[model samples]
Structure formats: structure tokens, C-alpha cells
Target: MRAPGKLVPVVLLVLALVGCTNMPPPPLVTTPPSKPPPTKPAKTSEVVIGVDGITGGYNPHTVADQSAVTTALGALLLPSVFRPAADGTPQMDRTLMRSATVTKYQPYTVTYELRGDASWSDGPPIAAEDFLYLWEQMRRAPGVIDSAGYRLIDNITARDAGKVVEVTFDKPYPGWRSLFNGLLPAHLLKDAPGGWDAALEDGFPATGGPFAVSRLDQERGEIQLERNERYWEQPAALEKVVFRRADQVGVVDALRRGNDQLALLRTDSVGLSLLGTLGNTVAVHTVPRSATATVLLRPVGEDMSDARVRRAISALLDRDALVATGTRGGPGSTLRAEAQVLSPTAPGYRPTRPGGVSSGQPELAQAEAALQQAGYTRGAGIWMRDGRPLSLVIAAPAERESYVSMARELQRQLVNAGIQAKVETPSADQLFTESLASVPTGQRTTGAVHLAVVPRPVGGDPATVLASNFGCLQGESAVAGAQPTNPVGFCDASVQPTIEAALSGAVPVAETLTTIEPVLWREALTVPLFQEADSLAVRPELTGVDVGRAPSGPFDTAVAWRRAPN
Candidate 1:
């Protein structure tokens, strides 16, 4: 037994030695330490907002580009000398402006001192050139929101290495704070492809606010904005903000799925119903827009060329009835617009409609009288002027529900008045930039758009609105050899001086409106119907969402928006 066991141990030992020699003794048999569990990627700090649709040409100063998205983008990316208060008064923006004061009375000079650190995102200081660019463009460009305040500027001189701006006006402008708002990047826009006419048609070249546009994907219907780290003021709280385009149903679905944190949509019956489905998860705010639904009778068209005929049409389409029809189930249902110069939501708004004017009941008699005075006779239940029937084309933006609804209502009213009107749905761009714009001096406008149901853009300044909606075209004054075109295609030479007086502070705005509004009403160019409204839906996760003080909707304080802890 000793001899066999000794032999077996000897055999095992030999095999083990052979294995150790080949495999390096089992690599010392040490246990490898475990790595810390993979860290979760830091969640992106972002807020996604659902919007109706994303269209380009984001210049907030132009009537063709007037939109809530344009206003919101302006508030987020552009710099302004003044921002509107809760009461719609222009308040100095301390972040970009140091002091803005009327330094002289003889020449009516306003001096603006900009913060030294204020600069655009692309390394250019926010300077007097920006002011001069806006002034020149507003004064010369057609289809601008308002140019009356800018047209008063006699000269603009720079000081303090372009940080201080000395603007001398031909007359004092009480609404000076409204000027130079949403300042453009002059260095980039001045020599760009389209200059003032086409500037910002795509996206901002440089930003002067708390957020900068990082991406504008039209195909994806998304606009991505990133915090402007170079901003002189406090940076935006969130790292990113996204505007996603969605229809009414898509908006509600996005909110339900927690995909969208906020939404600013045009108010409609269907949209309101859909948003109601979100229930307690979202807070719905009825945000009145800084615009009014108005019916414009363009004189350039043959049917509306006669002042009496225009008056007839204006009287036939009842304002109260249009308001009720256009604003049903919306926030503006109770906000009736009666002033052509200022919306009911605007500061210092006053009813400009002359007293003693009954509702549509009395207006029918007035319409009949005016139509007879214009030599229009009823034939086959349609008004006949010359040998042609008074069959006019009514145009409205297809995208806006209120405008389209109001247009249909207007058509009904005209039809009941023995007038024929055919409704046309065109994109807003075609309607504002082409159809409603004034024709060139030696040219004629080619369209059947006699009546337009459109949004009259209102602002903080009453005088600016007066001139913007009715001012005569000033051709080639700011730039040499440029053609002039009116915004509304209606101008009264007699009232032009009075409008200028209001814009220049020569006449008190309240007094000037009293005089000018009656003239506008008699001209029958525009009839105010109701205040426009927007609906904002916000999720509970959002902390700083508010209907901001600015007319730019709920994104005015977007820089301070934050998400609650998960």
C-alpha cells in the first residue's frame, strides 16, 4: 500500500507541476474589483413648447411677419430699449439701457446710454448703429409695423465708442420708448443679401438677449434655442428651449404624454375643447393678443374705390355681430374692439366709434343710403355699379380661425345687404405682403381682394398705430431710388399732418386720437371688430411660466423659466 500510494502522489505531483509550468500557476488567483455602476447620462435641462405652426420671416416689426411666434422670438433673442409693463406702458429695459432721457428740447433730442457690457452674441457691441439701422429701415421699408416714430428722427449721432446714442428728432416723440425696439444686428443685416427688406427672413444672425437660436429646422417644424452664455445680464435658467409645431389634437396629445411643457395656440372652439381634455395636468391661460380683428376695405380694388361704397360696406357689416361671431368661446368674446388706432387691450384705449350709432339695426339704413348715394342700385338682389355687379372678393388668412370665421360672417352680412361677396382663403404672407399692400406709383395691383378680414396689429403707442395703419407712403426718402408702398393701401393727405402731429408729440395722443379716429371712420378703410386672443397651456412641472408683461405672449420671462424637481 505504501508503495502504490507513493506512486499515485508522485504521478499527481508531476501532472500538477506540468500544468503550473504551462499556465503560470493560475495567475496568482486574485479577485478583480468591480467598477461603480455606469452613471446615468445627465438629463438635458430643456422645456418643449407646442405651437400652432412655424413660419419664417420672423421680423416682428413688419406687418407681414406679425405673429405670436414672431413676438415670442423677438422677446427671446433680440434686445429692446424698452419693454411693456403690465399696463402696456413702455418701461426702460435696465439690462441693455443705462439711461434714456430727453436731453434737449430745441432740437428734440433723446439720449440713450447703453450698458458698456451690452453686446450681441457675435462680439459686436449693441450700439447707435443698431438704432440708426432700425430708424432707416422703419422709415423707408414698406409693410412695417410702425414708422411714424422713426420718421421723426432728424439724425442719429454716436458717442462713447458707439455705446451712447444721440437721436435728434424733427419733433418731440412722446412714444420715443417704442422706437428702436427689437434692434437688429446692423453689422450683419446692413450688408446681408436682402438688407432691411429681407433681413431676419430665415433666422437671426446674432442675438442680444438671454437665448440664441441654435437650430431652425423647418422640415422638422422645430426651433431650438440655447442659453446665450455671452449675455451681459443673467443667463436663461434652462439650458435649452424648443418650439415644436403641432395641430390642435397633436398639442393636446403632447401635453397628455408629458412631451410638451407649454403651448401658445390661437384660441378656437375646437382648440378650447381639446385643451379642456388635459384637465388638471395643465393650466390654461387666456392670453389676449396685442392685435384686433378688423375689416379692411381696400380702395385699390374697383368695387371699393368709391368712398361711399366703402362706407356702405362698412356700415352693412355690423361690428358687434362680427365680434360675437369671431370671438365666440374665446377670451376676446367679451373684448369688443371699437378703435382703429388702439386695441381694447392697449393702454389708453378709447372707443373711437362716434356716439349715436346704433347697432346693425340702424346701420342697415345708413348702408342703404350710402349705397344709393354711390349710384349702386339693387338688381336681382345684388348691388349693381356701372354695368357690373357688386360682387367683391373677401380675403382672409387661411391659418387664422377668427379671421376666416369673421370673413364668412362678413360675407353673410354683405349678402343680406344685397351685395355679393366671395370668400377667398389665402396664406397670410400672400395677403399682407401682396394683396393688401399698396400698389407702386405707376403700377396697378392685380387682385380681387376688395375686403380683407385681417388682424390689425396694435402696440403700446397709439400714434404709431395711427400712422402704421393709415399713413401715406414715403418713397425713397431714407434710401435712394426705392419704391414706396402703403401698408393698408389707404391714405388721406388731409389727415397725414394730424397723424404726424400725434407721432411727434406736437398734439396729445388722447386729443389726437379724438380727431383722427373720426377721420379714419369716415374714410371707411378699417372697421375694428374685436380683440384677438391666444390660449397658453402650461404643465404643472413648469415653475416660472407666466403670461408675461410684454405683448410677446407668455415667453417674455423665458430666461427665468425652470423645471420643478422630478
Candidate 2:
């Protein structure tokens, strides 16, 4: 239920580069300062970048590329064919391509004219052949992200001595600019292993992105990047940027002390505290993030599995209460409730009911009757189902303070209803794998996963969201349950046609939602959670810090963002 999606690899690329050294270091964020908040901000000096360790390989094919990082990196080089226009439409930047045109009929082809002046960071002129190479590689590459986009292109033809690139799609495939989501080093990858299924020795040799990785400290989990002076856009104002791995609290403290310029705040106390104290700071820039967090009411657990019991539990859960008391709606008032995976910023956004936190569906009496139907009796202290105590384990990433805290609150509320609830939290890594992993498929992980506090990127449209992340979903609904354990689970039987229609750039928003709404209402795999606000504490001198990409992603012209007195 999110956009500008970053597919976290659960089964894809698992191993960190063991022997790949000449390989480009884990992609690092090039900053006004690449290093962590130094003892103090430099008057005019190199920018240091701070980031978490990207252990599972930074390859784009792998779901774990954490694409926002790559998008930021790509900002310096190739521009997306469709950039977010001021009018809320994704428009083609056309910096590399002189012009792109698509005819409505036959093969559903799209042809692009390359700007003769455009060149790779290495100085090789960009030709239509470069687009061919990218498409071919996308088709053949095993681990590439967004297979759907690649699947659409039936054939690639290069003409005019490889200066004209024409692509033929299988059907009336639309979504004209989705191809721009990809960033390529066309000159080098042109001859490498077609689809980059595995780590190529030097697949990322050419320089084009805003920053080219310069140093990597695997042992210490540190990375350094240098700006691409050859970048097509204005070269980065700063000389260097560095990233160091640090936890949430440490990152927050660094930001406060001016040691860390900015942080990609994950779900943790740091974000919470920042929300708590936002008013006291310069300004905290928050936005409607394109991700969802949900709770799957399981009826088959020890005390669950009984539909009646599950329904009772579902009815009793005052969703409004949770929206009011739990998550971001706490004291700081940072959380925003939403419907569907589309964030407010995503195109065609409409607020709807989340999960089964049913609106206008009160259930004190309904819960009592359902419990009785499940043969559950409300005793003095606990709930009784067949003379046994009704209890459930609210699984969550135990290591995440934010989750654990929310779990405790949930447990308390559940206790009042005579159900004993406990939190089972795991480490951050396990948390992701567990969320992506499913319930038992006949004793195997069936992807019956209930919920997670995952953050989704929010810069693009819903079509972009489906192509990037959020195809996998939870429960036995038409779309999600139709397929067992969707790797990119975003199943909405009705949504498929709209997606198909939207891809062709035809379906209107009202029509697309008309089809998508029923399936969503039927299976609440995704619940509306609190919205994220734009919260950034900046010095008055720091001008041009575009708040375009927040939560975590590239900002418009982040590198050009000056530290003032320019």
C-alpha cells in the first residue's frame, strides 16, 4: 500500500558482497556533507552523508535496492522521463531524450529520440542504442526491480545508427513514462551480463549519478561518495559526501547537535521525539508517505481460527480509538489516518476505511454476541473459549522501540476486553523478513503475516507504486489470496484491469477506484495509519532544501541546495 516502492528482498538478493571489492561500494547518499554531523558544520567544505548499511547488495534488480537512495544518486545523472510536474502530472524531463512519442495502435510502441548532447558520465554520447541496452538488460536481468515494466516491452529496435530507440509493448500497454524509473550506465552495462541477475565484477563502473562511490568500510559499515563533476545537471556544490551507520536515537541526537545534517527517520523513538518537539525546532517537514501498516486478525492461531471469535475481536477494536490513541496520533499528533496504499501526495488519493477499523460499525453488543457464537464466555478475569483462556501473540519487531511500545498499548487495550495479548518483537532484519514471509502454507511460511510498521515512498503515482513496490498483500481476498505469498504483494482482482487500463493511459480515476474499492473493502490487508508530516529543522541560511522527497527519498536538486550566502 505504498508508492515509489522499495522492494525489501526477502527471497531475492540475500548475501552481502563477500568478494566484490572493485564493485562499487554500497550506494551512499552524497550530501552537502558526506560525513555524519561533524563536530560542527563547515563554513564551506565537503558534505558528509549518513546512511544505514545496505548489506543485501545495492543491485537494482534485487528488491532491496532501497530505490530512494538510488533515485537520489541518479538525480545527478539521468533524469526520470516523467518528473512530478507542478500540476500533479508526471511529465517527461527529456534531458537525455530529445523527445519521446507513442502511437495508440499496434504493438503499442514508444519511440524516443536521444539528445545528441546527452552523454554518460564517462563522456560517451548517449544514443538510442543505450535505451536498447537498458531494455534488453531489464528483460534478461533476473534480479531487476519492476519486472512488469520490462514484461510490457515486447521488442526493442534501434535505428539511425542507434540514435533512435523504439520499444514495442506486448499489448495496449500504456503508462508512457514508467520506463524512466530505471537508471543506467548504458556504456558499461552494454556489454556486461544482459540482465544483471548476479553481481557483475564491475557492472557499475561508469560515473553518471550524483555521487560515485569512492570508499567502503565493510568491517565498520561505512561508505564514502564523491560528486560527479561530469553530471549532466549542475555539478554538486559540495566536494564529497560520506555515510556512517548509526541507530535512530544516535542519528536524532546528531541532528540536534548539528552533527548530522538530516536523517531518513525510520519507525522509532527518534521520529516520535522529533514529532514531540517539532514546534521547538526550526521546522519539521513531513509529508503523506506512501506506505501502510496493518493488523491481520488471525482466526487460526491457538485461541483464534474461530471466525466468530475473530469477528468479535475485530468488532471490538474501536479503530477510531486506535487512530486516536495509538501510533502517531499520540501526544505529538504526528500520525495521519488514511485509506488504500496511495498516500495523499500520490495521484487519485481518496480517504477510505482502513483495515476492518470499520467506520460507523460499533460493536459492543455485536462483539458479545459473536463471542457467545464462538462458545466464548466472558468470565471474571479472562475470555473463555472451550474452557481455555483466549490469548494471542501480537507479533512485531521486538527490537523496534516504536513497535514494542505500540504493542504494549495494544496489549493493554486487549486486556480490558478479557483477551490476554503479548508482543513478540524481533530484530529489525527479522522483522522485515517476517512481515514479507507468510503464514504456514501447509506448515511452510504461508505469508499469513498480520502487520508491520513499514514506510512507503510517496513521490510518484499509484501506477508507479504498482510497478515499483506493493503487489504482495495479506489475507484470502480476490487479489492477495488469489496468489500465495506475493513477493511484491498488491493483489486487487479489480485493480488488475484498472492497472492494465491505466498502463495504457486511459482509465479515469473514478473508474479505477470503482473496481479497486470492493476488493479492498472485502480484504482489509492494509489499514489506514497516521500520516507523516514534513518536519525538518534547518538553519535560515540553508536555502533550496526542497521538501519534495521526505520520510526517505531524493529531493529535487538536493545537491544544489545551498548553505546560504551564495
Candidate 3:
């Protein structure tokens, strides 16, 4: 996985609080009117959701402080230029944007026209300055989140006063739509004492969506949002929303006791058998996460660096068995076995078999034959070549229970093929932070891990991820300078051209991916196991519940949720 961006300490504290089972007490819930003497009230409904606590203020641009809770809340209170479709393609939100078009391909340029009626709760119109301010911050700010797309933009200028904005990019970036999904209000943040950090620490200054923050009680682990009457679009169906911090176990308890309406549970934390007990009382929704668990082979060593050896190892392990055991035979158990770096769900994914090598369904006999062809002779139940045992050390993080289980299962499977495999569960910091960096002079030996079980972050475009992991390395950088994601030192110059073409966005995504898929399988750089999916337990009465393709949770479409007719 890629290293996390700089975040505030408070946000980390909140995340830690949410991860542990012993949660803080609920916040003070505002009481309703005792007497019914007021005029007929607007139809009102409230939903209490149990989630991992909201840390890092509500600003989505603050990358370090951003979490699932932060992104979900930002989706409710801010205006997104484009929303992602089910296949991870960006679709323009007609409510906020009148139209968005790419006017030119070279020196890429795009023009956005904002809806005439769109305005902040404080009555400030959404204008070109807002876009300009965000662009400037993303370019100059050190702690801002995901500046890759923004850094490509040369400039953004206002046209026709504040109604339209024209953007020019330094290069042809295909994933431009992924940017500005959570636009911050410039007028409110411009004069903040500590800049964007201090301005957004308390909560949002104003809201453009259907809901606005009514109260934020961090000490009690709660956030309350009420309808935004100033919203320009159709009024929100639900009157109020309450987000309370709870662990996976607490979430199940809250839903069963009728204290909470919905909860998102990690499959690793809550087994499938436990969810089955809920039966028809609650609705379960499986959300696909933009990440995949893979086995990365170190490409530098003489023992395993050879492509034949990697292919043999790939053939020895059963990916379907790993998925089944890791997911505990749940909704995501039957995951599509992947042969290349790109995920099955990613835009440019294509399954290719080079030399008739099967991508899934392990063939132990073929694996043994390949090792024998490589001049390895079996002795004392282990393959040996040039007086060296065919032994491998696989490293995995201790936190993810699923990955640990997969590693153990792989270890057991490899033993049958005369391979001695050792699985090491290291601390997250050691495996992710220290081991990935270049070792210092006179330091202890770098953790020369032969294989690592890790997840790669997948987002709107696979180009960036593909380039970072598989592209050729520029120069000699030892394990000290090595990146954790590419620890195997596998860089193929042959695949660079196709990767560049995909990054340029000039070619059809499907065609580009289809061409690259075979090269990856032929080389056998990494073996992809399965894509990660999240599970949610929602009450049957809540309707219009939709899980977003983006990292945000079900709240992505919170405005559409309504109570079922009794």
C-alpha cells in the first residue's frame, strides 16, 4: 500500500478510539417539543448510524486528516463536480454542474459551468474563485490530500464573471474528473487564522448539499447533521442524521438492540456466520473496496528473481482457496482470480493467458516440473539448486487478519511442492514504513523479505498505480531507497510504452489494458488474490440505501433515504 499522507494527531487519536471496542459514551441527544401547539411541522425523520468515529475535521482536502467518516460527511455538506458511476467512471452531477466538457486534447483544457442557483448556506454563490482557491491550496500546501491531479493543472481562470471556469493542464491527465469532488468554500476558509487547517477544524462553515452539521461533540464521539433549508436542489427526504462512533462488535449490538439504524462491518472483524444470525431482520449490502491483496515477489535475488521461478510459485498456490478461507465463505468469497496488477473491477482489466498458462486453479505437477526444468533437484523433501534450499520468507502485516490467514494457507500449500515457506507477521511500521525505506549506513541488515502479502490501493484510474508498482526503476536504489509496494524490484521496460499510453488517456482504456495484461502474466511479477469488499448491516425499514463506488460509505446518497410505509 502507498504511504499515508500527513494528518493531524487528533485525527489519529479519533481513529484509534474508533478501532478499539471500549467506545466513549453517546452524545447528548436534543429532545423534541413536549407540546404540539406549533403550526404543522414539515415531515421529519431521524436516522442514527453507528460508524468508526469522525476524526480529522470535515474537510476532504486535508489528506492527512481525511478518513471514511470525513469523506462521507463532506459528501453531504459540499458540492461535488462529478460523482462516480458503478464502474468507477465519473458522471457529472447535473445538480451542481450545468455542464463539463473537455475542449482540447493537447495542452489539455476543460471548462465547467456551475448551476445558476447553487449557493452556500451563507448565501454566497459558488463561483470561479472557489475553484481557484482550492487549486492554489492543492498546489502550494504541503499537507493537502491527493495533489497529483491538481499539480497537473497549469491554471484556472474565471469566464463570464463567476458563472464559468476554464482550466488548462500542463499535461493530458485522463483522471481529471477525480479531482474537486469535495470542493471547500473559499470565502469561509480564506481568512482562517491557521489557514485551511484552523478554519475547518470545528466543522463546515456552510453547506451546499441537503444536510449541514447541527452539532459536533468529539469528546462524546458524535456528529449531528440537520436539513439545510438553504439548499438549492430538492429538499432532503430525511430531516436529521446522527453519526456515533462504534467498533465492529458494538455496531452489531447497537443494530440488534434497536439503538442504531445502520452499521458498516469489516468482514475480517465480523465473521459471516455472525451476520447470518441476523436473518431477515436486517438488510446486508456488500461494498467493493478499491484495493486488492497480492503476493509481491522480490525481483533482485538470484534464488527467486528468475521469471520461471516466479511463475512456478504462482502455479503452486491456489488463489480460490485463499479467497474462500480469507472471506470466511461470505458474499465476497467467490472473487475473480486476477493474473496481473490491474484489478478485475478496474477500468482497463483483461484476463490473458500467455503460453496457455492458467491464471487460476493451481497445477502442482506443472509447478514441480518447472522447478525441475530450472535445474532444481529434490532432496530430503525440499528442492535444492547449487547447494541452496528452495526456501522463502513471506512477510505480512499483523493487523489484517485476512492477509495473515492467506499467508498461512499459502505456506501450507507450498510445502507440498518441495518448497519450505516461512510466514512472518511483522509490525505495521516495520513492514510498511521502515522496511520499505532505504537502509542507512552502518545500520542493521535491511529486512530482505522474499515475498510480502499486501494490498494495493485502487482508485478511479489504474494508470498511476500501475506506473508506481511495475514501471522500470530509474537507477540503482538499494532496499533502503526501495518503496514498500515494489519491494520485489520488478521493473519491465517492455511494459512502459503501454503504461505511458494509458496514462496519456489518448487510447481506449479497454484496448490499452488488454495489451498490457498479457505482458504482466507472461512475466509473473505479482499474483493478485482477491479484491477487498466491505459489508454493511442496515435496517429493513430504511429505503434508498446505495453504496458508492468511491471510498465514501452509504451516506453518499443520504438525501434519497426515506422510511418505508408501515
* Most lDDT-accurate candidate: 1
Per-residue lDDT of model 2, residues 277-380, tens digit only: 53443345553333343444532334454456656766666555554443454321344545554665555667765444456234677777888887878889
Residue 46 miss distance in model 3 (angstroms): 2.4
Report lDDT (CA) for all predictions: 0.80, 0.52, 0.70
- Provide TM-scores for the models: 0.85, 0.66, 0.69
lDDT of 3 by residue, 102-140 (tens): 888776899899999999989999888889888988654
Candidate maximizing TM-score: 1
lDDT of 1 at 160: 88
- List pairs with backbone clashes in candidate 3: 6-64, 298-488, 299-488, 437-480, 438-480, 438-481, 439-480
Please give the RMSD to the true structure for each candidate, in Å. 5.8, 20.5, 19.0
Candidate 2, residue 261: CA error in Å?
5.0
- Residue-wise C-alpha lDDT for candidate 1, range 109-138, written one tens digit per residue: 999999999999999899999998888888
Between candidates 2 and 3, the TM-score winner: 3
Give the TM-score (vs. native) of candidate 2.
Answer: 0.66
